[model samples]
Target: MDKHFEISLQNRKLLYSVLKDTPKDVLCSIPSGFKNNIWWNIGHTVTVQQGLLYGLSGLPYTMNMEVANKFKKGTVPEEVPTDEEIEAMKGLLFSTVEKAQTDYKAGKFKEYSPYETSAKVTLNTIEEAIIFNGFHEGIHLGTVLALLKAVHHPKAV
Candidate 1:
């Protein structure tokens, strides 16, 4: 496996750990301090990855822009997205990752637009996007963990 995929998988594993035991209430509840609930964070990250990789690669994005805009960085979650929509987003997230693995192995990204890492650094290949995705994933995982801890008390002996 390429190093980018390896890193991306590691980040995915961490996200799985965080999501595995998250209470449904926590997933759906939007606390005053958090921008969105755990579910929204997960969906937004997955949506961004699919859009950047699939959409930029000339493949149709499984997620529509209206849903994407709901969780776009600057947008506030004024209303909660339905459970059905969240489930659909989750399905797309899984399938997109599988498709991306095949696309990367087959060198399908040769024609995609170049992605910049940040304003200061530019990425010229899909490999860079995968690596950047890992970094972005970790950031959201940290936020989820912190929120989980903040909202609930740690177990005591």
Candidate 2:
């Protein structure tokens, strides 16, 4: 596997552990001023990966349209997914990440949208998408950390 695919697989492992430890109640809770719950973060992190990989790579997405919209960019979990639905979505999230890395290593990307990085560089290759997944995963991971801290800090103290 390439470096990018290797990094992506490692990230998926870390992300899975984080999500596994997150309580359902905490996952559904909304931190102040945020439109999404932890549920959305979990699912969105996975969706964006697939979007960057499969959607752009010319492979079929394992997630259906209904689940995609529930977790896709722009649509918050509150507006589309019930708590139960969000839990179910979590399963799909884990599966897609695993599949995406395999697809990515196979060089199946389709060049759909032009993605720009946080560094302001625009990417037109699957290599860029693989690198970008780490960036995207880190962003969501930070959000999950904050959510856990906010909801569990008082108890911890």
Candidate 3:
């Protein structure tokens, strides 16, 4: 296992912990000042990983396009997530990383189209994307923490 996958897996593990430990109501709640909820962040992270890795590699997405697109870039969290959608996101949390690791070991990523992320980082390879994904996940993790605080905050509005 390379370091990138290791880091990515660890990040996913933390997020998975959040999913399992947090109540469903809290997970589904969008803080008063937030644009999206913890649920949206979770789905967004998974969708972004699939898009950046599989989609950019000219391969099919491991997740359902209809569900995944709901969390794609430029999408909002106006509608609350269904239980089915929540379960699907939870299912992908670890499987996507595991499958990506397997695919990478099997040389499934033959080519990559360079993309400049909004953060000004340009990824030219799977390794870079995977590593950058950790950073992306970290940001969302921070957002989740903030959302947690907001949910309990008196000034959440």
Return the top candidate by TM-score. 3
Tens digits of per-residue lDDT for model 1, 23-136: 556666676677777777776677767766776677766567777777655555566556677556656556667778887788877666776544345655566667667677
Please, what are the lDDT tens digits per residue for candidate 3 over residues 1-157? 4887888888888778777777778888886788888888988899999999999899999888988888899998768667777677778998999999999999999999999999999999987888888889889888988887888833222
Candidate 3 structure, TM-score to reference: 0.91
Better-scoring candidate (lDDT), 2 or 3: 3
lDDT per model, in order? 0.65, 0.69, 0.85
lDDT of 1 at 157: 10
**How far is 39's C-alpha from truth in model 2 (Å)?**
0.7
Q: What does the lDDT come to for candidate 2?
A: 0.69
* Models ranked on TM-score: 3, 2, 1
Give residue 144's error in model 2 in angstroms: 0.4
Clashing pairs in 3: none
The C-alpha stretches of model 3 lying farther than 4 A from their native spots are: 153-157
Worst 10 residues of 3 by lDDT: 148-157
Write down the TM-score for model 2. 0.78
- TM of each candidate vs. truth: 0.75, 0.78, 0.91
